[model samples]
Target: MSTTFWIIIAGAIATYLTRIGGHLVISRFDNIHPRVEAGLNAVPAAVLTTLVAPELLNAGPAEWAALVVTAVVSLRGGLMAMFLAGAAVLILARQFVG
Candidate 1:
């Protein structure tokens, strides 16, 4: 009921409408060009690598050590290994730090 609430509601509505509008417009284009499709496919991977690279490389000693353990487990055990290793690291970190 306040001005801030109305502003937030308006912003949410605008965001939703913009996304829906993009989908509608792009849907009318019969087929994506091959280059554009390839770019789209690579976008998420590029973004994720950019996001994860710093965390994986630039952390403190324990964090780096955890990542090493994670990498070993991840390589040997697949996705499950990654999750278990991450959980172990998180628990250990909490115990030591917080």
Candidate 2:
């Protein structure tokens, strides 16, 4: 009914179509070249960096510190650990340091 609702619906449909189209195209490929595989593997990280880097640059010290800690912990931990550690550090730093 509302403009925001319609926008959300359109976004969901677009996302679904994009994913299905990618799957359909990839499934037809009998053999993927090494370069193409490398490019495909890089896509997620590239997209993530594009989404995160700008916000990170504008963040405060607490957020920066949390991100640094998360990055370090990511070497030894899973995604859940990184997320929890970052959130906890940010909360604590905001409460005590800020």
Name the top lDDT candidate: 2
CA lDDT, candidate 2, residue 27: 76
At residue 26, candidate 2 shows an lDDT of 78
Whole-model Cα lDDT of every candidate shown, in order: 0.80, 0.92
- What is candidate 1's local distance difference test score? 0.80
Backbone clash total, candidate 1: 0
Candidate 1 structure quality by residue, lDDT tens digits, 5-64: 999999999989978986887789999899999997898789978887888655775676
Name the 10 consecutive residues with the lowest summed lDDT in model 2: 18-27
TM-score of 2: 0.80
Query: Stretches of candidate 1 above 4 Å error?
Result: 1-22, 69-81, 93-98
- Estimated TM-score for each candidate: 0.55, 0.80
For model 2, state the Cα shift of residue 20 in Å: 2.5
